[model samples]
Target: MNVALWIAAGLLAVVGLVGGALKVVTPKAKLAAMRGGEWTQGLSDGLIKGIGVLEVLAAFGFVLPRMLDIAPVMVPVTAVCWMALMVGATVTNQRVGQGKLAVATVMYLAIAAFVAVGRF
Candidate 1:
């Protein structure tokens, strides 16, 4: 279970870091033009960037506390946060007619659910 949690955390951290960085740095128009990014069309730049920041923070939350053996409880808390984010992503993608993306978010949500239950 420990090893599984580590792997799950690593996967989510990579996804969060890469995806969040893309959201944070890319312009709204460019992001909207990208594949799987149509949902950006309905969101404000500030909201998008804020979500990006949250993702980056959640990435760190998954690893740092557990790695440093400080406040390790944060790992499950981070997983919960990720689950919430994935729920929103699923909804947004569905609304934008990105059914495949919505399905992908469901998978991420599952992983986060696993981490939450396993770690907690």
Candidate 2:
């Protein structure tokens, strides 16, 4: 169980890092992809950038604090935050009729939940 927890933690950390990097580097393109051919026009760039920054911060929260044994609470906090974000994503995608994205969001949320439970 400890091994499983560590593995899940590592996987989620890597995913958060990579996803955040992509969000920061290619917000427009990624948003487009997420929207499934729908234009993200009228959406505030600042909002997108904010989300990107948050994602990166959450990514760091998932790993750095735990590794340093400093502010270890951040790990669980990050998991919870990611879980919430995934839930939001799932709802948003479903409302937009993007079934695949919705499914992906659910998967992410599940992973986040698993990490949370395992760690706790």
Candidate 3:
């Protein structure tokens, strides 16, 4: 379970970091291509970038504090934040009639919630 949690954390962190960096650095055209033009349907570029940064920060929050054994509470906090973000994503996608996205968001949220319970 611990190994699984760590692997999940690492994967989540890497994805968050890479995704955030892309959002921050990529142009609209490139981003649109990557998202198959779906990402921009409801979200502005600025909002997308902002959420990306927050996700990256939350990913760091999941690992850094716990690794250093200082303010380790941040790990669970980050997990909760991630879960909240997924919930928001799920709701937003559902509102926009993006059922696939909503399902994915819920899946991710479930993983985050499981990690939160196990880690904290």
Candidate 4:
């Protein structure tokens, strides 16, 4: 179970890191262009970038304390946080009528919730 949790954490971290980095680095115009100009429909660029930063930090939160054997409780805490973020993201996508994005967010949310429970 521990090994499985670690693998899950690594997967989450990789996705979060890459997604967050892209969000941070990519221009709003580019993102908007990709998603039919609806990616940031109701969201400001600043808010989007902030979410990116949080994602990156959350990825670190999942790995750091556990890796250092310090405040290992933070692993589950981070997972919960990640799940909450995904829940919000899913809701937003649904509101925007982005069915595919909502589905993906739900998958991420489920994974995060599973990790949270398994790690805790």
Candidate 5:
């Protein structure tokens, strides 16, 4: 169980890091210009950046506290946050008819939920 939870947390952390980094770095216009606009549509630049910040923080939270044996509860908390973010992503993808993106979001949400449950 510990090994499985660790794996889940690691996967979520990497995903959150890369996805959040891209959201933080990429220009809003550029993302909106992409096909289907599923990733950035219906969201303001500030909001997107804020979400990115949350994701980045969650990424660190997923690993750092638990790994260091300090405030390990943050692992589950971060997993919950990750699930919320993925839920939003799923909705966004659905709104834009981006089936693939929606599927990916669902997968992330499932993984995050698993981590949350395991850690908690």
Candidate 6:
């Protein structure tokens, strides 16, 4: 279970880092032009950046606390936050008619839920 939790968290961290970094660095226009990025069209730049920041933070939260042997409770908390973020992503994708992206977020949400339940 521990190994599985670590694997899940690692995967989540990698995704959060990559996705968040892209959101932070990419311009709104570019993101909106991307295939799965149409959802950004309905959001403000600041909100997008804010979500990116949260994602980066959640990435760290998923690993750092437990790895450092500190407040390991943060792992599950991060999982919950990731779940919420994924839910929002799912809804936003659905609104933009990005069914594929919505399905992807659902997969991520499932992974987060698995990590949350396993860690808790």
Clashes of 1: 0
Per-residue error (Å), model 4, residue 15:
1.3
RMSD of 3: 2.0
Residues 1-120 of candidate 3: C-alpha lDDT, one tens digit per residue: 988877777766776788678777776667767643465565788888898888889779867887898998787788888998988888787776778878877887887887789888
Distance from true location, Cα of 13 in model 2, Å: 1.9
- Model 4 is weakest, by summed lDDT over 10 consecutive residues, at 33-42
lDDT of 5 by residue, 2-119 (tens): 9999998998889888978877998899868867566676789999888888888888999999999999998999899888888888888888789998998899899989999988
Poorest stretch of ten by lDDT in candidate 6: 34-43
C-alpha lDDT (0 to 100) for residue 105 of candidate 3:
76
Deviation from native of the Cα of residue 94 in model 3, angstroms = 2.6
Q: Model 6, stretches more than 4 Å misplaced?
A: none
TM-score of each: 0.98, 0.83, 0.83, 0.92, 0.92, 0.97
Off by over 4 Å in 4: none
lDDT of 4 by residue, 1-120 (tens): 889888888888887898888889888878888863475777889988988898998889878889999999998999999998998888888877898988988988888887899988
Cα lDDT listed for each candidate: 0.92, 0.75, 0.78, 0.85, 0.87, 0.92
- Candidate 5, run of 10 with poorest lDDT: 33-42
- Where does the lowest 10-residue lDDT sum fall in candidate 2? 34-43
lDDT of 6 by residue, 16-78 (tens): 999998899988999888877779886899999999899899999999999998999999999
Q: Which candidate, 1 or 2, has the higher lDDT?
A: 1
Better of 5 and 6 by TM-score: 6
- The residue pairs that clash in candidate 3, if any, are none
| Model 5 ranges with Cα > 4 A deviation | none
Give lDDT for model 5.
Answer: 0.87
Superposing all C-alpha atoms, what RMSD in Å does each candidate have to the true structure? Answer: 0.6, 2.4, 2.0, 1.4, 1.3, 0.8
Superposed on all Cα atoms, model 4 deviates from the true structure by an RMSD in Å of 1.4
TM-score between candidate 2 and the true structure = 0.83
**Model 2 lDDT per residue over 1-120, tens place:** 767766777777777777667667776756777646342444576766666677778778777887899988778778899998888778777776879978877887888898787666
Better of 2 and 4 by TM-score: 4
TM-score of candidate 1 on Cα atoms, chains taken together: 0.98
